[model samples]
Target chain A: MKRRLLLVSNSTLHGGGYLQHCQQQIQDFFGKNVKRILFVPYALHDRDAYTKTARDKFKTLGYEVDSVHETPDPVDAVRKAEGIFIGGGNTFRLLKALYDSKLVTEIRKRVLEDGIPYMGSSAGTNVSTISINTTNDMPIVYPPTFAAIGLVPFNINPHFLDADPNSKHMGETREQRIVQYHEELDTPCVLGLREGSMLLVEGNKATLLGSTKARLFQRGKQTTEHDPGSDLSFLLTEAQ
Target chain B: MKRRLLLVSNSTLHGGGYLQHCQQQIQDFFGKNVKRILFVPYALHDRDAYTKTARDKFKTLGYEVDSVHETPDPVDAVRKAEGIFIGGGNTFRLLKALYDSKLVTEIRKRVLEDGIPYMGSSAGTNVSTISINTTNDMPIVYPPTFAAIGLVPFNINPHFLDADPNSKHMGETREQRIVQYHEELDTPCVLGLREGSMLLVEGNKATLLGSTKARLFQRGKQTTEHDPGSDLSFLLTEAQ
Candidate 1:
């Protein structure tokens, strides 16, 4: 099978219905025969919540899910799996833990070289990008870490939204933030994705899924909004 | 005279005018005696436009204007100034040059130790913080280059406004960003300033300026709003 990729969102789970959207996407990728390998990189603080939840979810799906923590080798568990899913939490913390354990490199190898069916939601999706420019965290404490799996050429700004009434900051809004990003970087497209939206990459083509809009930002100009209807087959078929 | 400090903004005499809001804050800091010291750190690429325009502005204020590239001893120039200003432009380029030249350290010393009045606009304000998390630029190709002057303990997210009508990405709004920042960081406050807003810090005390509300975010929670009022002597006196 081709290397399949699914990006789930971490914006909200309001009503305990958050995981349903993600389940639909997982089914789309794995189908009935899907065997899931879930990674909870962000729940280092609360293993029971993030990790156990994944185990329960995968078990319900009739697929086995295991948590990888201390290993002489990081890839031993993921390499044998057909589908890999990264759940969301504190992206910075999740990325920090992954880097500390040195699991990111292996995951990258599995996704990029081995072409495993890779899926990430929230923090998981964040790790797939070139960097986390769109993260809503402060720069005071450096996480002693860096960007995502480099699965795609662009940077991912997860949980992107417009301004709110309660805020006092001005300048380029989230859209403007992407515009500024384009103005600065030469390569690396910025993908501004909302919740329930997934960028599925299969065999050199990437496709946008779900209800929200997937906006693209290039260097030297403003952002242009794209939808699943907008020849998104280019995303699925684009070269690695 | 106090060491010369100039506040450089990303705005020009005629343009998008975003920097003007910051300029007004700097003026309030120095009052009518505001001595303009123009220092163009990145405009070296376009010598004609950046330098000529900076020089003209400085001459208009009856003070000396010099580029960081032109000054053989930037340290000396910083020492003799009443105030120093770094304007905004391509923030990445400006920061890269300052970081490469080691001017950021020298500028920091002049402000913190020598007690010279220091100011910045847009990119200028960005570099004053311990980190540039509020900067609306890409984090991937740029890396996490948050080597700013560190004049202030916290980060400044200026030009605060609500979201535009025509945009798509749905993440945390700007207010939510502040909340998330506070959740992650411990002490460094996230000051969300609107176009006319500013924060005056002298010693351990600080005050907020502008007619609009200034929101404070701490320890990963939603922002708490505060109206600074028209007068700011309370903060100035407290800082002293």
Candidate 2:
């Protein structure tokens, strides 16, 4: 079975309700077959509050949400989940929690082999890539390793922002940091998903979703912008 | 013997030459007694280029610069050095190289035990703290541990900037990220060292040196601002 994934750049936009804009996309991706979603709220600091927020959001979309934290066995929950949803928060904490629960391999197997639909936003989207090396979050905690689920070929830098032309700040811009990453690690392109943007994957077909353009970065090459409807499926086969 | 440290937030200002703004402080930190200094260029991508830059800058300040990478025995060079300097680059790379060369312990002993004057900028300054947890650089590579030299009691977030009130970016501000860090690990305080700022340490006395104010963050406490020339020696004793 081919895999399906919805990688969102952020859960809430400025002055927007939680996952409000992406509700239609969420409904379209899962269809009517996925009646229940096993939510992973590990990225959040307050897991109970995060789970409740997600539960309320999914309920409005006509689906029952069961958070993995409330489950007796998270691994078993993933094994039987019709779909999985990982919310956004600190990427380090989320990755550490995933490792601590030993859900890395199980999630990969469920999504890649079993064809269970998977969805993640922000830090959630960050961990769906090959590694969490490109995250913008502070290293509040160190994980055993930088490796992630590797469901996608390239790394995702969610909540990507363009440099302010009039700013006086001397810190590196997001583009410069991504360029530095390429300078150190030659392979693996970085996809900069701006706010209100997302990537949709179905089998081998990957498409850019939402209104904003996504920026793509590779070593020794100029960054290119892709429009919302453009096909990014080629990225799947580029990984070596 | 008392340990002496000069932790600079950046190597250069917006329109200035490398180390141009901090030359006087560099000279004042290492008096006429120090004839030669050892440079650690491992943080940069091009060691030779970075070393030459440091050598040129130090020469103008009347001190001979010898890079550890050029020495046949780096450990021996660190042991006999009068002063040590670490240039700015990616913090993760610098810490990893320090571990790879087994220079962490040697450098620590030389600076903290023997009282050899130590200086570092940007990534260099980030590693001088207890951990590289508050750095703004991308995690291009994973180090064996986030554990650094622990020369200072608190972590330093170098090149820190305040939020732009007019900006529409949805990403977390520098202050917010540091606050999140405290929420996870509450004990250690985070000092937001703006560009052009440096911390001068002599044993237990630490003074904020520069023309701008530095922001300090601690868990459950309001963020405090300290002006230039203010005494921050109290932070040195707050480690427990």
Candidate 3:
């Protein structure tokens, strides 16, 4: 079977409910066969509250969500999960939790080998890439390593925004930062997924979803803008 | 002798030459006696170019700058230096280079024990604190640890700016990110130092320098704004 994934830029759009914009795509991605999901809420500080919130959201979609924190054995939980959903918060915290629990490899096996459908938003979308190098979260804690689950070929910068021309802020723009990342580690392309946008991947093929255009960045190359419905499956083959 | 430091928020300000805004303060901090200085250019990718640029800037202030990269023994270079200056680029790269060169403890000893006058800008300023936890730089690489020189009691967020009210960016604002940091690690206070501002430390006493006001954040307490010249010595005492 082919691997299936829905990587969302953000759970909530401005003035919208949590995960409201991506619900239809998420529903279609999981389909009717996968009724139960193993949710990873480690990105959030208040895991219980985050899990409850996610549970309520998934419940409305007629899906039963069981957070990984509730299970005694998280590895076993991943193995038995029909579909996986990881919510957003802090990428460092999420990656650290994944490393601490030793569930990275297990989840990879389940998603890549067993072909269990996987979905993530924000920090979750960040970790779904080659590494969490492009995440915008503050490094509140130090993870053992920067390596992450390579569910996708390239890295994703969730909640991506263009630099405002009117702003006087002297800080490095989002593009400048990503360019610096390329200066150091140039192989993996970076996908800047704007709010309300997502990448739907099935096996080796990936499609850009939603109305907003996504930005693609590569080393020594001009950043190209891809409109919605453009095929981004070529990114998977370009992974080093 | 008391520990002396000039921790600058950034190297260059808007519409100013490199280190131009803080040259007088830097000169005053080092004094006429400290002629030869050891420079750390590890934060930047092109160390030679960064060092030469920094050297040219410091020469205008009547100081001889020698980068640690040029020396055969970096640790020894740290010990014998009259003064130390760390240039800005990436905090993770700077901290990682320090750890890789095994110069963290040596530099710490010189600054904290020997009372060597140390100056740093941007990423360099971030390492002068308890850890590089509050830095605004991207995590391009993983260092051995987040531990830094701890010359100051708290962490620093360089190039700090207020959130724009008119914009509709969905990402967390600078203040929100620091607040999230406090939620995770509440012991150390976070100082949001604007680009034109700096911290002048003498022994346990620290004063906010430059014309702009700096923001101070502590857990369970309301965020406070301090104008330039405000005494921040109290922060040194509150470190855990």
Candidate 4:
């Protein structure tokens, strides 16, 4: 239960550069304790390019960062890193890479047992939850399963967009998709993290943070919207 | 391969009733040969209600339909069916149900070996392709794998939408998602079935049908838009 995580709904907000929207939050969360960050860039196609972008951003935020893909042993990279940040891309691809590289358990151990701070955005945030079942991403590639890092107790749906009352699209709305998820699984809770929204978890306490509102959904219960400073401790205590 | 499929992009179009937009294509695909349709209502939660809706719609078009859930042995129902139709809801839920009930092989035999007409919409159309890797639905549940009926040589992306240039959403557009699929997979081809569009496949022949245009994407190639009445027999011959 000693989890310390900074889960972001999106990497870059609209009309902004990469990680520009939440620079101060990210820096404050990591603080001076984390000198270097181990970056996972497997979510995108070009691992080197993705790594360079993340490395540069973290460097700008006053931290030295290296990508796991650059290391000969990824699990070893996780074992020795001071901090970790998995960037946003396709969830399935990211999870598959995690499983393939055997970094899932190592990262879990480092964050929970070793007490290193973990950061994630979009697809990264989706995988840090109990499962990737609520992701807005297409099943472009299927991993071995939908199982992901169980860092937190509840599921996270990042980049969550509300249904537009003016549009007439035939596809299911984001709310309807989460409703269907609740109907299908015994999963206890799912948090809809809108763009520019984020969550900070420290041990037993969970706090909603960012510029937008977050949504809380439970099985067979009405969903409620939460403001930036709302306490989401109920989700951590609920059944998974 | 005697695969006969009427793959629809969506069940309903903007401002249209259930299955109202593509009623004629469905009627022509099944023809007078299929006296009764054995509907797979597993994609939806309320199978009975879903069946009733489909039954009523097909009844108006001069065909009798019964749901697989209403029957005791769903496998037997597929074995003895004149035609089969799987409605849209959640792709993960539908594929998991299909795998759980052991109907994937049965339905494949009926559609391929027996030459019974088959119809699918949205999620249904996704599972009918080589894999459910290109589906637009959220993965609400975990199936055994991404493997599907493989009734066709390529994958189908149902309810496909182009990226709105003016919109400032950071989420991957439908095109970007498909592009990512090509990047991660050796998947030979994927067809983006826009809303109100359909595809008809019969014995080594596949043709674009319905009102809207379809977009085609191949690995490491430029995407091309195809209009209604365009020949897509190339898909049937591509490497899967």
Candidate 5:
């Protein structure tokens, strides 16, 4: 029940530089016991460059990397792992592959049941929950991937915000889309995560991470916004 | 707000072959006001057959036959008509075309806002809700058409139960998916609509249309099932 899970975002990995703030937090959370970081890249391209870059991130943080797909025995790889980090990419692709390979169940057992320290970023975090309902992608891609590792409740609406000003498409705003989801759904929480924000759930307590606010919508009323990093300590201490 | 909005189900036309039980209920719901029947095809090759066949259905019902398309001018077509029934086709394609043409918004205004009785079967019914969050399709096609007219609060997961015994793929059960949706959603209220079931939302009363039951889910609790023909009178009646 004391397993540590760190879900991250991929938007920061773009351009030449990276956001050190989150990476620093990941390192701090894992501490010295974090020897082997399992890098999950089911969300990115099927190419090697993307996977290698994710691997390098952990290497830079002084931990060994094992791409989940490269190994013949994922169970064995996970067994020897100290920390598991799911990198950001297309959540559908990553979740699809994980579901197809039946790796999600293993990861769930390792992290939730067996207390394996785990982490996910972007799509990684999106799939950590029950369903990837809040992903900011075209809804047409149905990746034979429905079931997810129930690491946390609520779908992660990553990179959530008003429509980018530069983009010309007339798609519904993130708020609107989520409102639509809330209109349809009654239980799973929808977390509109800003950049560097996260919901750190340990035991019975769930904490919100990051500097800005996260939006929560329910069935009976309009959405309510909450500032993260505020009184999230309940997440670290609660027992489920 | 009562406007002429026609909803068509592909399963009902052509002598009500696909879903026989729903045909009478659907027709009865529309009563004698249906002015036209536009038979849409699942494939392009079947277009002619549908047009000819649907024209007969329209004639039998003492209505006109009009050619329907994704970009039909609603103001021009439904102006003199009592209703415009859009027969079901591939839900994704029909919806994609509707969305691509930006007709969904106009149609929404006509149907929900203007009070048109828009009815659909299969895909037609599937697309009327907020998003197609509840359709049964392989995740292979990520169409940009998942968006829908904001009619109902909940997404319609049509064809609720897979009656076929020999389906090979093992994903979440429809109930499981909705439950997962509830667990993941911030505010979840999903309706597991069976073939004959519908929510007849008139004024403040959204009565159940068929004899089949609909299921509802909530977070941290067991799922609840509702009987058909029960009074959902408060759903449409209740103010937002």
Candidate 6:
């Protein structure tokens, strides 16, 4: 697999500035070779504002951001882009727009085949998996399907939180929700990416980035937590 | 409009027994004419256990519970049911099961025309609305569509929580997610049913029941909060 993905849990940490926590990793990931990156702002409602945020952020990192919404042909823009970054908002809205613009396949090919670096924050990270079934966002809109880019073999649960037993909230916690998913399907495992954390995959070798620990949920298996710099390369390949 | 719905936020409130807080209202809604109430326990994985929980609780309220999952013919169960109660779990799983069993149209017809007393908690309450778009549940499984039973004129955001201003979590607040839904479509409104609360609809009147307040979100209108006993009948009617 010739895939390079920086799947982030959240764009901004609790008290940190926007993408300030993951600045160095993002800069080093895109590097100098990828001078221009295409930005997908469909996850959010205001594309103009989202694009401006990405433009300013990337500008500081020494890269130019060309928003796909501004282009008449998104597929063509994707084909010619050096790198791609999808800012997060609502997962359903983002996936619906991806299907509406017919950019899923093009973007997948660019990342998996052409090896263009792909960075996803929150909802963007959710859509990069086999399905967006594990996302915490409201449906808001119905996509053509829950099927996503499948850039990775498993589903990604971004901004994942553990259950607080003493809490008054009666609704099932994030862990319980993932358990329900496991009850229905067994094939694609789910990775619960904690806040402030991101997963970086460089071809066959994948590593868990950031200070937070990530929990992996595989059917019929005990949930395992991985620390930062731990090898998650096995996630890049599906279990037969 | 012959819709009779008891759409609740959470089945159990903090420090309360299961369905304990809303016991009297549940009994009153069904009344003496209804004997055996069919239970849709498809929301949870263990149908038998879910059915037992529902059966034991309903028995104390003077009703017999027959689970739809236990019946060989689920469609027939809905057709012959005197009253219906949908136990809550994962909203996506419940909706997917409803679509899989070909019960969406049947359930809608039964409730809309037959006017049989219907009760929903959490996920169940979510599907009773115009769509499951406003639900807080994860899409563990993809339903045929986000279009739900449409038992009411608006969408229901079950177990609605107010944003804790002091919290540091970076995910979109409950209020922001509803705002995003409004930005996309202007038709159906959204009703945020807070925990310990439920909406009681009888014929033409829909009242907010319980000790908590409910929030209403309509496009181009100020967000409104209604206290318990306030008439939300307007939500039962689609704005034209």
- State which candidate, 3 or 6, has the greater TM-score: 6
Which is superior by TM-score, 2 or 5?
Answer: 2
Poorest 10 consecutive residues by lDDT, candidate 2 chain A:
A178-187
Q: Write the per-residue lDDT of candidate 1 for residues B1-240, one digit (tens) a residue.
A: 132333232343223343344445655565666465637556124645666666665564455666655777766776676667676554555676676676778888877787777767666777777667665443433433655667766666655555555534444456655554554534466566665556666554456654457655555445567786533223222121
For candidate 3 chain A, the 10 contiguous residues with the lowest summed lDDT are A179-188
Q: Once superposed on the true structure, which residue ranges of model 5 sit more than 4 Å away at CA?
A: A11-16, A139-141, A163-169, A232-240, B1-240
Q: Per-residue alpha-carbon lDDT of model 5 for A2-70, expressed as tens digits? A: 656766544372232443547777777678977877777666555367667766766788778878778
Write down the lDDT of every candidate, Cα atoms only. Answer: 0.60, 0.90, 0.90, 0.90, 0.59, 0.91
Candidate 6: pairs in clash:
none
RMSD of each: 5.4, 1.6, 1.7, 1.2, 18.8, 1.1
Name the weakest run of 10 consecutive residues (lDDT summed) in model 5 chain A.
A231-240
Taking chain B only, the TM-score of every model is 0.73, 0.97, 0.98, 0.98, 0.76, 0.97
Q: List residue ranges in candidate 3 displaced over 4 A.
A: A238-240, B238-240
Best by DockQ: 6
Q: TM per model? A: 0.75, 0.96, 0.96, 0.98, 0.52, 0.98
lDDT of 3 by residue, B1-240 (tens): 479999999898888899999999998999999999999999988899999999999999999999999999999999899999998988888999999999888988999899999998999999888999888888888899998988877888999988878666678889988887887855588899998999999998889999789999988798999999999989888543
Q: How close is candidate 1 to the true structure, as a TM-score?
A: 0.75
Better structure of 2 and 4 per DockQ: 4
Which residue pairs clash in candidate 2? none
Interface RMSD of 2: 1.1
Angstrom error of the Cα, residue A101, model 6: value is 0.9
Candidate 4: stretches off by over 4 Å? A238-240
Predicted structure 1: lDDT: 0.60
